[model samples]
Target: MANVEFETLAALLEREGALPSDRALALLREATRTLSDVHAAAILHCDLSPATLLLSSDGRVLLAESALARRLGEARQPDTPATERIAAPLYYPPEAAQGLPLDARTDLFLLGATFYHAMTGAPPFDGEDPETRALQYIRHEVPPLEQRVPGTPVLLNVLMQKLLRRDPAERYQSAAELLEAVERTERMLQKRQEARRAPAAAGAAATDTPRHGKRPRARQSTAPAEAPAERPPTTRRAPAKAPLWQSKPLLYGGAAAALALATLIALLSRGGDSKPQATKPPEAPSTASAVAPANTPTATARKETPRPVVEPPKPKPKPKTSTAAPPREEDTPPKPQDPPEVTPRRWKAVQGAAAGTETYEEFLKRTKGIEVVDYEDYVVNWEYAGPYRDPACAEKCGPFDNEFPPEKPGEKPDWAPLPKGADAGRPWLFNFRNITQIAQVAADRAAIYLRTRVYSAIERDVQIWAGSDDSIKIWLNGQIVHSNRRDRAVRPDEDRKDVKLRQGWNDLMVKIGQGNGEWGFCLRFRTRDGEKVEELRADPAGK
Candidate 1:
């Protein structure tokens, strides 16, 4: 089967208009159930909005774009502004916008905001601009759903109000509790609809009853007297007082007698007798008498020897026997197996000891056969510094203010030659290197520095492609080449800069800042013509 493409709930709302209360509640229940699972795992979806809620054609609801998710107890970086940390400020709760510590209820508030928009076709918090909208989340109360979209279910409106509560304590404490309320509201709406249809159905049934009852009586009165004889004595007996006009046998006999009397009178009149002798009219039985005898034999026969009801024979149970052949193994049903769980790829630590220090001759030997030095090949080794933080610095911190600053690129820092210690700086080698996954630092709200040296055979212009989780600044040969202070998820090639790589080894330094959630950065070098650079070598430990 081909994979199905899903559209976001935001797109659905735009094309089809706001969802009805029942439909909205059903989708909310599905979304909340998924949130409950995430909460159980001690994770929080820091970003929740209509654009992040995926809707499939098959009616499946899924949460997407979870790069902003953080651990339950994780706190935002003290130095990082809350505005830079949130993916969607319109959906952020008061506590989140204030840069305070968050829990499961933080996500619940966002979930409510997203669904409130799903039902009302607009976010609960509104302002003329993004800044104003974010402020609304902190300072203003959300307007009631029913007030915005009249005729919305009262229970649904009340539920939404609770979800959008300004204080975490007022909102549902857990996703489980929210899911239960959503389900209850859904059931109540269904019952109300069923109740509405009940009376209409009953009225229709009432009108049909009398119209149907007259049919059987009409069929019985007009039927021929012999009609009952066709059935077995045990099945039927003719009616005793069928109308005389309705009985065929009685009507036929009466007509014949009237004709005979007419003919006799005509003969007597022709003889001219003053007083004609009374003619005997043919005899005709009464309607009851005619119908009674026809049915009397059947009634008497029914009482004398009623037809026997032959009951169908009951099926006999098969006797258990060891002589029966056993089923073949191939014919037996296979047991069902669960689908394998797919885990997201995470950075793994490189193994094996570092190759001590290599001479300048060794670096040449390593690059002798290598024609091209792509981004990955250029990232062989790096010296990582503290997962540092300064609340006042935020995204504005520079090399001059940090603990250790290299005078120039490619040159070893003064701290590098210091005696080995826990806090001492040293070169770290990577067997499997992705610049973005280089340092798997435990802290989220902090900054880190990575410096490496690259040897180029000759001068050439190259394009640098870089991406970062939040903020990043790059230096080539101790000269700043690129800087982006805004926070965002890492997407390779999000930033590009052109620079010259002079002959011999040159220093390259990168400083990345993390606001919250995931943290990382990626860098690669491509020739001006978009081709990979050749005859280059990476030297992390200056020889």
Candidate 2:
């Protein structure tokens, strides 16, 4: 018995749905050779399906040659063949289903069905139940390739049809014939690809100038005052003309336009916040970073490997460009995160340690000097603080944990553009990707101050699940909705809370307490019956 271990092609197809044409062709090529070798041994492989053929990521195929094959007598015949019909109904041949005599062509029919499924994402007999599927394979005709998969190559489609013919006499007589057909189609495909690339490469080289890096400096003529009298006559290259697009005047104009466009884009992407962006501010005692501006990333918690920044050439008339201004930072485009489904909302968070009503009290009395927090209408961006004192208001502060929905925001610096790439280093919650998970300096105990406006198209019951290290407190639309202080490892939906969401936007905030080990929280919204809140959208433009 030929036994080999590898991922099965059927499993691969199910995982990836369907494969590209080139990859599918390569798989079929290996299958052809493996089947041909098995048939040459004068043994009929009665069972052939994607699952029976082991495949590898690096493009190798092995057929499971077990009870599937029977030894042939003289005249190349099986005296008593296996009649168990073990192949999948999707790939089962008509003769095999009817318990009729089978031969090499039996493998071809099953192989065709496999290829059909690989390219079309559906089996030849795609009926739901086993009985309906088996009957379809026995009687249904394979649809034309165009009908099932529009762009399949006609030659490959033709080969598949010939292999799938119901009559054994009409199908390819042996595996060797099918192999030849695959080889021919591959060659034609190779030629077509080369033909397509030939003109495209030439055209791009001629028209598309390389814009990857800096251009070369201009070379100046250094002819001496006295030329060599006996120098051999050399062709004097007439002063090489600059490319039309590279003329000094035109280059200057283009440079200015590009610089202005970049500045405009940067401002637009950051939103219309004009707050000062200090590199670092005086440290303050608070949860989250006390003095860090909204634009500032937690330098103590994370750091990216720095690259040398190079300034671009300035237009000739413009003053020398600033070497200190960041060059590489602007090049990194912001990634678009898909909004969470269940927790019909999104949040922006600041980190804190040992978060509780005391932290909230200090944040309120020390900073805002207010009793209640209306976070929805909160107007200022507060500097992040650790699980300590509020820097702005000092230790002499009051708590507002009871104020479920604070009437407004607390002490905060100027509102800067929303944090970009703040969640760079850490992994976000699986379902709630919009909310970033920030690491805390203290391992076991930390808290985050988060705020967001959650809107729903209709009023419905929404389930909220949160996981924390030690304890957690959440405020929904200004009401303290959830409070859990038991210490435990963080996991998704470790603590579930169900609440009713009114139609339109609702405010939500949370303070997660950390005691030891990994500390962070995950929150999301789902329906009453564990369905996603599909009608939810956060901060949508114009509702």
Candidate 3:
């Protein structure tokens, strides 16, 4: 195995006792959703313990040994309490004992349990004896997360409750669902923190506008002083009574929302107008923004609180006049609206690209696959099965080749259009945000195809760096360029080869094969000394 350049998450947590909830929340939420995406590709991660969740030195999460994670539809050994495979038994569901099918929900339960353990300093159903813990798990008898950790966010606590539910039907159906809640909670927490920094004097301006013509205004303290010291830090965060996303109902989209945008727009206008009394009392305290927290708490760091700030008086309102005057620059209230942040782009490869599984012994003669002719762009498929989302193979095959029944003649087989899968004539488009299991259904054999692209670039010395789980064969401009057949894990640029290209559109085709484990390939252009060959353009679809 190649040396992984990070430590386990458990080590980080052990090193860092308590972290600021936001820092910890962002890391956990993002990582959990990534694992969900992996499962969406039909891989099962039996090891969801903290040790398998690795943290890079710079604080990013990287999954290790996913190649070893079990594939869905593969037969698993019968289960016994002692024979169960999860490294940490406490992070699993009762289905392990009940002999029920494990799906994405299983991982959802584990993710919630992992977060609960991190926050409360104990597993949700901890006990002195293994028997007691298992019994509690089977009975759905874990303590509510909020009771264990008094200051936890309401959304998180409720989410954890649903996640740890004993009945799988009651749990989140997918990581996508869990991730939606996570992102909403993260944003709510951030918005609450920002709300805390609003100066108290700003309330006076709001108070001046009467909801009813005769409503009395709240009196601002003439002699302002610092806030009291004994307050709990969490008090500034208002009760998250409503999911803010609900405020913009149009996003949900229905006949009910025909009035939502217009109604919300009016409410916002009124909120901007003279009705501070209605808005100020429920206004979450804003003094917390006095200063930034000491540092972003990491897994190994203690949780840090913001220092209190002294509130400055907001400028008193100017007298109303018939002759309007231009508003003073400082007189403008800072908008509660925050600027949206941009996320960095990550690598994307199309997931389903399997042609058909070919028996290793018969692949040379029996298999119907692609062979490059002029190499401008051409896609070939099995004559019997045609292009299909699921493949029909002759024997047991790897997960990458397990989507369909083995090939059969005169058997009008069941087939469906490949979802976001490539089509014949048009090179199967295989673009996605991460490495994915492209296609499946053969065994002890090879399913081979070529991904040919026409590129426009200056005539120069260039290189192709590729990484694949299976050995890869590459042809550059109709010449035999490079071939390597070895068992290796998929990574960026596991191998590189120098190639020559013409100034006009140049041609390249890659032939990929399947190995026992996960199978796919990563290919990109780079200069001889190693710069992304950004000047080249490629149309793999030949359109």
Output the number of the lDDT-best candidate. Answer: 1
For model 2, how does the per-residue alpha-carbon lDDT over 269-324 read when each residue is reduced to its tens digit? 34324433322233112312333455355432232312224345656774457545
Candidate 3 displacement at residue 43 in angstroms: 0.9
Tens-digit lDDT string for candidate 3 (507-533):
565555453434445566677998645
Q: Ten-residue segment with the worst summed lDDT in candidate 1?
A: 344-353
lDDT (C-alpha) at residue 117 in model 2? 81
Error of 2 at 127 (Å): 3.5
TM-score on alpha carbons, each prediction: 0.37, 0.35, 0.37
Q: Per-residue CA lDDT of candidate 1, range 1-543, in tens?
A: 157779898898989998887788888998898889888998888888888888776677888867778888775655565423567857768887777778898889888988888888888866545654665576557889989899888888899899889989999999999988998888898899897878787888889878688889988888979986788786555667878787989888989999767754553333322322322233222332344455676545544442355456779767766566888977976565532233111101010112446443454455432222432433534566655655544342222234434433375543222111121231121211123333343344466677777777689898887777667788898788888876565576788899999998888887777654445666677788876565555555543
The C-alpha stretches of model 3 lying farther than 4 A from their native spots are 1-5, 66-68, 79-85, 213-543
Model 1, stretches more than 4 Å misplaced?
A: 82-85, 200-543
lDDT of each: 0.67, 0.59, 0.55
Worst 10 residues of 2 by lDDT: 344-353
CA lDDT of 467 in candidate 2?
70
